[model samples]
Target chain A: MTDTSATSAAAQAPSGVVDLLGLLAYAELVSFFRLSDAAGLAPDLAAKGELAGVAATEYRHYRMLHERLAAMGADPEAAMAPFVEPLDAWHGRTEPRTWLESLVKTYVGDGIAGDFYRTVAEHADAETAEAVRGAVSETERAEAVAVRVRTAVQEDPKLAGPLSLWARRLVGEALSQAQLVAAARPELAALVARGATGGDSGEGGSGGKGDLAAVSRLFAGLTEAHSARLEAMGLSG
Target chain B: MTDTSATSAAAQAPSGVVDLLGLLAYAELVSFFRLSDAAGLAPDLAAKGELAGVAATEYRHYRMLHERLAAMGADPEAAMAPFVEPLDAWHGRTEPRTWLESLVKTYVGDGIAGDFYRTVAEHADAETAEAVRGAVSETERAEAVAVRVRTAVQEDPKLAGPLSLWARRLVGEALSQAQLVAAARPELAALVARGATGGDSGEGGSGGKGDLAAVSRLFAGLTEAHSARLEAMGLSG
Candidate 1:
């Protein structure tokens, strides 16, 4: 279900590449802000310092993505603008309430997003893909978040139910916003489409399962990875 | 005023150095959190990116200061614990309501702090002092904050009156907190007293102006610099 205009545009230009870069850059920028805020939510000074350190890396990643967009002659803000509202809405709706919620968000929610982006990066140019990989690299703070979550749930078995529900909600909210973004940005949709019908085979290949089927496959892959992450965290999807 | 205990301690130990480093390290950590929060208050994505970038530098500075403390066999969290309340109170009492107010806080509030710390750093051990200097160095985002404040005030002359009052409040709140921190940490007070009496001339000499008078003089110098900074931003102190 490629939009006719998006198909036309995808045929002639690489707006999808620009859209993808823009989305990634904006995501990094937002993560920088949110992760730093999460530092304040940390229960201890050591945790705060660790989260703050993690937040800094997000900014570095944002700079790299912005630079890549600019080198390609795109106004970074303009490129990123399209995804802003959806992302903001997702964050606004999914505000973490407690320190544990914040940790879970970082470990489970961000883990899923990181995986999705890594998959998308596979379809990008070499440099873009490398930047994506670097940006999504989980630091020790993330590992710490995972450790803390596992310990907390193990100590309080009752917490697993609430946290598991929270994790599911996070995934639901994330996927909803992702759909919103894809619906609004056909160029990005086309990029996913192109990536789906075999990499570099161009958008809407002759016998490909069309955009909707390809997008379904992409979501299925995302869901499978997300379930694996939840199970690792001792939570059911 | 030198407490009898602080004077005796200062004569035998470098607790003053630890206090100074601790204050600075904690300051960087809090700034990392708040500056990143400020990025959310930015009016545009570009400004958001810039503020977020500024926030990242604070974490790097925090790491350097934390490393210095760790190298000195100090527990970073415990060393930082003492000043946390005063700093948190200061931030709580002077929370910025608007984007412009947030900018003013960073430009005016943090400017005064950076200057005061630089002056205090001069009294510390060379390595600690060097680390202090490195942590407080302003990046372009700070400059951009200054420029934005100046331009906003210039564009709306009416804004100056309220902003000027806000600047005064920020300084007052900051000074009040500084007084609180100084009163609680006698070792830090002793460092100021020694620095005031002229560095490396021993703790107490016949030519010294005693602790109270010397502290008054130090505040005077800090006040003068603060006033000059406000004037540079076109705000009356």
Candidate 2:
């Protein structure tokens, strides 16, 4: 744990918490909706039911974060409004045409997003970090997607090339959306910069150079995690 | 409750139970999916969340019925397979174009379907009756939809006309699909026919004329109940 004084100083800027939670809450809600939409494409009843079950879990997460925002006297809708466009755009740009593409998108897209949230949680207050962790903790469904995709690709080696290209497109679209979000929400960007500088080597230190370096490192971290996810699914990033 | 011997006679036909449970299971699952889809139309976050919560409840109902089917050694997929086409066609025919239309469909459509299931439950064996009753019992969400539609219509009386027509269309499409289902599933039709005769005047009587008369009474009962629902919604039949 960091020094108590340092934690208090960061906590003074609760807007950052609101920004993160708001973003995560909206993401969860949209993910729930999209997952249900994608469930329609499943080839069989079992797969459809499983995806619907996962979608329910996402709604639960959305509720938890939404309630937290309400408790803090924030309008959940107002807080989530900024995120609707960027996230919806990402979903629109990388629309999954088939059930396999849908599975890969969920696996790879959610994998990177969850990792980014966890990394950002480190710079947040304990409560915020814990909430973020809880919201993203349900990985069992992702494992199901991973196993199913891996098996499908194994059975048909031709699928790997198309799916790999799909994964790359998902990553590209996600990063573009992330850039839009960062450009629009400076508080969130500043928070990340602070998170990068205030930990370990330089406590409570930040600057433009530091922010740039931190963002680059964050991108590297997210990319590496995405590669690991792709590798796990027996595909190259 | 009817005579004990009469109940035992109906219990001999387990296929009817399987058919009922399978239809209810698939209905619950598809309702969950469609509700989530409709939630996207909600004007605000709270409404969206409420609809999503209702969708979750439907998922729980699906799980309950699905588990019971599995316990009874029925393949839920195969059992539900017959239903999918009819239900999908029903949803496709009466697709809601607006948020208010969606609410009316849920309020009126589900209201009638639930009533039918409950009516059918009377002929079901004790265990089957309880299960069907359980699956169709979550009416709190429907009540919410009713209140919302009623208030919206109260605020603007013009909605009453279109929504009333939409509700009628929903009922008409649902009945058409029900006819399709009855034509396709002989076991289900036999069960319904058996329900017709054994319920009222004759405790254990079965004849072609008697069965046809019973079906007429069943239709009348369903129509009457649907009229009551329309009245409750401040609309005409």
Candidate 3:
């Protein structure tokens, strides 16, 4: 009794939301690979073990995101395919060359991504929002890495300048990628717009095409936190 | 009052065991790294996850060995120093270049090492023997890798020749290294000989020094297992 065309259309539903999920899933996968690889650079067994522990946590996150994508009627691999090239390229371009660089990468990159997810989760539906909440909460491990870096930098003033510069580049490239994703996916942009401008408030705002305010708030919070961390490490923000 | 010479000698009493324990501890650490790195070559997430699980198990072994070494009145770092260069050289020389090569390395190298440990464990005192027993039993995960490789090789006849050659080379190199260790430390070699020969049967056999019988038995069992695995994979022994 159902129209064949309608069934096909349903099956081929626009997967903009799925694309966002895919992005997050691939991010976790690449993070796992990078952290696991970087663990080799640790100077001692204890530090190596700690880094390996962090790598294991990243794999756990990948599994969770992968399952969520599968539950939403998308092939996790196919959904993940489009984003892999860009994500890989980004990591390739910014591969950390030293122990401090590795820690800074985790602190700045993961910190901003976690903040962005927290804001996005607030605007998402319950299930997806809860997933984002879980992901952001897991950033505690990354915070531990940041604390280690902070302690190390404080003990040696010479480390501060290079690490601060590394942190800046990490944040800059991450923001550039965020802009690319926003421009590439209209549905994702629409989702952000809806989340940012909830209710029909046609007040001073132009047609609520996107939520620049929400975006700015997320970036500002992340930048402030990072700057505070740099200052604590005796580095200029 | 204690003589200064006697006190200094007592302070250095466990130095010899430190080298042996350190080698074992770092072996486990490097195994964890190599296995996890090689896990990337798996064709699917499920397979990759399984490999990661095994690699994590290696970390547990590394922790145990490390703790034991620390408890034995030795600085684990100092203990592990001497073997670092040699083991690192071995790994560098035998780095697997492809996925199949990695699997073969895991199968052949781990299989022989497990057999060697089983033989060595038989000679160790109660506590050391128990620890070795625990480590040997952890080989089940590595065995799974072998079984998977065997099945894959069976499915593709063309894979048989190269893999067989690879397995032979792996075992050959492993045995070469074992001989190197045997020749490097005569006292440790004597300890292994006593363990292998069991109670003062000290018939001391022909050498009146090291027992070749025990070494032969260990090598024979390893060879049998290795041949059976190669046969199972449809490759010549």
Candidate 4:
């Protein structure tokens, strides 16, 4: 009976994995569109080009996820279909209207998301962990843009208040939607919980931290990193 | 003295080729952004995915042009810089507001431009001609989108009038900006002239027709093609 249950669980794991990958894939797709559109909001050509380069990197990430999903025997389009509306609605509601707003969103939103992925990656299976790690690595470019924005804001302190407020709103919106996603997918939540317990040998739970504790650590690290970045740019920590 | 002059001109030709390649490179970059943005206007997830796939193919073209430009000892960015303002201006002035308008712009604008490149390729030297041919050949995806749009319009005759008007405007705007580019770069104009005149016999330019006559033939063929496409879609020719 235990063996049969284990076999059934193993069979079910792929569907959960497919759903997770599909969600991430669509997120990257939508991110590409948003970043590309945001490129037009840049104040100058070099900034535009840099943001476009970031956008291009997202396309590469999209392609990798797409190939992996196909290899896993799921049509990427079909896998991505379920989350499109909610994701689109979130982005539509949070569209940034200025260059600074866009940068802040990239910085705050992507930074925390990267950290969450890192936590999840610790408990995922080998292939799943690898995919998440690969995607998270691309966040560095967006981080660099954040650094640039911090430096620019330091040079003009009057811009600081507005950008900081924008960053706060971005995080709030992201957290809101993330909770929605988590609520909607119980299997994913359970997978995340297992990873958090440090009991799963897979990437998600391999970090030796409880779920809430792991999340707390992630937020702490992100906050410290952002503070250091801001200080390095001669801004308030 | 003759040898010195010939060597200088030969060296200069590569720079000209780089300019041509760079123009195509930036075109691919912008086209990727535009097509991806336009995909958001798509009514269905499948249509959106299809448009995104088309956008991704443009990056493949960009990589090819970037590699060729690097081989020719030219900085692709610098070569592309001169054309950016004109191209940006053209797109900014003719932003598509509707799904049908976006499709019409893609079909008419890209189709006509591809035709022009075909003519230019015939007049280019061996390597350059091959590059142009390779770049133009990547239009298969865009052509597929055009066919889909035409069928969609045929199914709904109400789409015919607005889309036809949009197509005309797209062509008109494209021609106006192309003339601006032609007037601004006399060397590029000279290259077009020389190529059209069949001056590089090393590439075997003609069986019977002169360069100008060949160019005229190309234009006629392109016009007829677009007319047939439009007519098939139940739009005004």
Candidate 5:
């Protein structure tokens, strides 16, 4: 964390909005790249094309957040630099081994991340929140993921066991990384912390009681939304 | 090929038009995937993002071709399925080892591809030609590729040698696989053959004289264009 990054984040004040946008931007780009690779696992061309289309939506979101960062006079790349390792580590650790696993990751994994980004964005400045929401509004592809997974599970019930396990792994890896990020950048943790308590509790020192408590609440909501998503695919989340 | 595919191709008449659209669609998807992979080699985040933007253009073009196939009552997946192995082989063999090599492939390789597609599109039916032209018209990203490759070459003169060799290998691999595609789908060969000759020369048997002669001409023109592109980057074509 250089003073310049601190200043960039501080310039956007309420602290960590630049971090938020930067994190989201890098996440989108990585997601797009990963999903394109996952298309190879698709059963057919229709599935492959649909998967590529979904990934393209992620690139569009990246462009939006990237532009937002630049407009704020923050170097988009510099802001994003702080995030590359953690995100890459998370994706690396959770590489999906099959088409169903990939779908579950896309659905269960991206589902929660999108949910988490939205929860934090709502508390940022009006424009930041709007920009984040606009970038994050990728519901249609999520529907496509849902239909494919649900139908596949319905066809062969055996898939439910392994896929449900895969979803758990994806969520587990995600929270582990999220915690690492929170530890490294307390202000971001505090930003979401403020949203959860509707008070200034996260103003405490790094990884303080206030920060962990609020993040727990945020993650709790995300967990619930997608356990239901797993169940919708006949999987035990 | 199956009797059903032959019927479909026959229904399209001119034999190779379905093959053309399908080949083009699959090509776009594979190019998009390769470019996404190449983004990882970018020197900085700006270059990575720009590379990704070019990849997205390929996806949009893929969507365009896919939809056009469906509108013609042809299965988009089926049309693209046949070219999958050959296209995948070509990409796997020619993986770029550096950012400049990737840039050259995008600029010089895709440069000629867009040219060849446009040249042939001009000879197809009005709507088919229009659709092909629309998807293939990706000039802006080409400008991005040219500027980056040219600048990189200018700054470090030594890059020109290997990059020039890489461009030649790229064109070589492209022609070798293209010939494989031609051998497998004579109708498509005939389609481009007619485009080059401006006569009904490709109407003979598979691997016919007219087909080979015309394809040579089409490829000759593509080669000339990209040799110029390579020179523009201070490399010998």
Candidate 6:
């Protein structure tokens, strides 16, 4: 509720956590919308059920985040408010045209977003970290999506090349939109950067706030994980 | 799994129950998609969350029906397959264009569907009736949707006329689709008819299979309830 016109004074303060939770909350909320809509592209009822089930989990994550924000005395709406446009824009740009495309998006998008959140989790306390893990869907859904995408790719080998390209597009659009989010809230960006490098609060790792090299390492890890996921799905990384 | 091309012999038999459960399952599944997608049209996060939460509930109901179908030795996917067209057609025709329109659709659509299912519930076994009640969402969701719609209508009296018209269209479309389904599967229709009239299996009430007079009464009750719902939402019933 502070007049955070600039993040200069408290770049990695508690408000940064609020902003992170807000962003994650809104992200999952929209994921619920986007994933469920994508279910329509499913060819069979079984696949449709799988996607819808995962989407329900996303809404569950959103509700958890919403509650967390309230427990922290942050306005859930306002926490999510700053995120609507960027998240919407990301979804707007990377809309899946086919069921395979939707599956790839689920696999790639959830994979990268989870890595990003896990990086941020280092800066958060234990409970918040667990909550972020719930939002990430790394363990269960990723495996389910992998099996689905892998089976689809095996059934139609032609899908792999195009799906890989589509996945790259998804990651590109996501990264660019993520930059917009980071720029709008420097404190959160700084906090995440410090967490990424395990930096002490007193000094920026590279003697600059949100050290570029540290952020580079963070995304490098995400990129590595993304490549592994792509390989698991029988798509080119 | 029987080749049920002719429903005459099996009218009011167990397959009729499968058909009903399948219809409900698919209805709720697609409802999950439609409602979550509609959440995007919400003006704010709270409204979006409310709609998405209800959509999640629908998915949970869908899962329950899916389990019930499997427990009954019916292939859940095969059971729901017959319903895809009519339900999809209904949604395709009645895609809501505005936030209020979506809310009105939710209210009217859920209200009528619940009543229709309740009429069927009477013929179902006790456990099945309870499950149907769970899927109906008559108590919690109706109140939630009403408050949301009423608040919107009070804020803009001009919306009342158009939204009321929209609700009527929803009911019309719903009834037409219901007839299509009944015509396709006479046993389910007959089962519903018998349930509507509280008749024993020995005789179709009024000396006809699925007595018209009883069906008339069933719909009269539905119409009356629909009007009361409309009135509660401050619309012309």
Interface RMSD of each: 1.2, 1.3, 2.7, 2.5, 1.1, 0.9
For each candidate in turn, give its C-alpha RMSD to the true structure in angstroms.
6.0, 5.7, 6.8, 6.9, 4.0, 4.8
TM-score of each: 0.86, 0.86, 0.74, 0.74, 0.89, 0.87
Better by DockQ, candidate 5 or 4: 5
| Per-structure clash totals for the candidates | 0, 0, 0, 8, 0, 0
Q: Give candidate 6 regions above 4 Å deviation.
A: A1-15, A136-139, A194-211, B1-15, B136-139, B194-218
Return the top candidate by TM-score.
5
Q: Answer with 3 or 5, whichever has the higher TM-score.
A: 5
lDDT tens readout by residue for model 4, B1-237 = 123333443455532455566677787777777776687688876566556666666766666666555555566677678888877877887788887777777766566556546645764457656876865777744667667777878788788888888776765676566666655654454444444444543133332224344444333454566776566445785
Clashing pairs in 4: A122-A203, A122-A204, A123-A202, A123-A203, A123-A204, A123-A205, A124-A203, A124-A204
DockQ of all models, two decimals each: 0.72, 0.52, 0.20, 0.31, 0.65, 0.74
lDDT of 3: 0.63
lDDT of 1 by residue, B1-237 (tens): 224444443343364777777787888789778776566578899888877866777778789878867766667788899989988888888888888998888777567557546655776557666766765675323666777888999999999999999988887887788777666665566565555445543256212444454455556655776787777677887
Please tell me which predicted candidate would have the highest DockQ against the true structure.
6
CAPRI quality level assigned to candidate 6 from its DockQ score: medium
Give a tens-digit lDDT track for model 2, residues A73-116: 56677778898899889888888889999999888867865764
* Residue A23 alpha-carbon offset, candidate 5, angstroms: 1.1
Tens digits of per-residue lDDT for model 2, B1-237: 234444444346444667877787788788788876687688887677777877887787788777666655567787788899888888878777788988887787677657646645786557656766765777545776778888888999998998888888888887778766765665565555445444544233233334444445545655677788888778887
Give residue B72's error in model 6 in angstroms: 1.3
Q: Which residue segments of model 1 deviate by more than 4 Å?
A: A1-15, A139-141, A193-202, A205-209, B1-13, B139-141, B193-202, B205-211
Model 2 chain B poorest ten-residue lDDT run:
B202-211
Docking class of 3: incorrect
DockQ-based class of model 5: medium
Worst 10 residues of 6 chain A by lDDT: A6-15
- Candidate 5 lDDT tens digits, B91-118: 9989998888888888866775576476
Model 6 agreement with the true structure over B79-107: per-residue lDDT tens digits:
89999999999998999999988988888
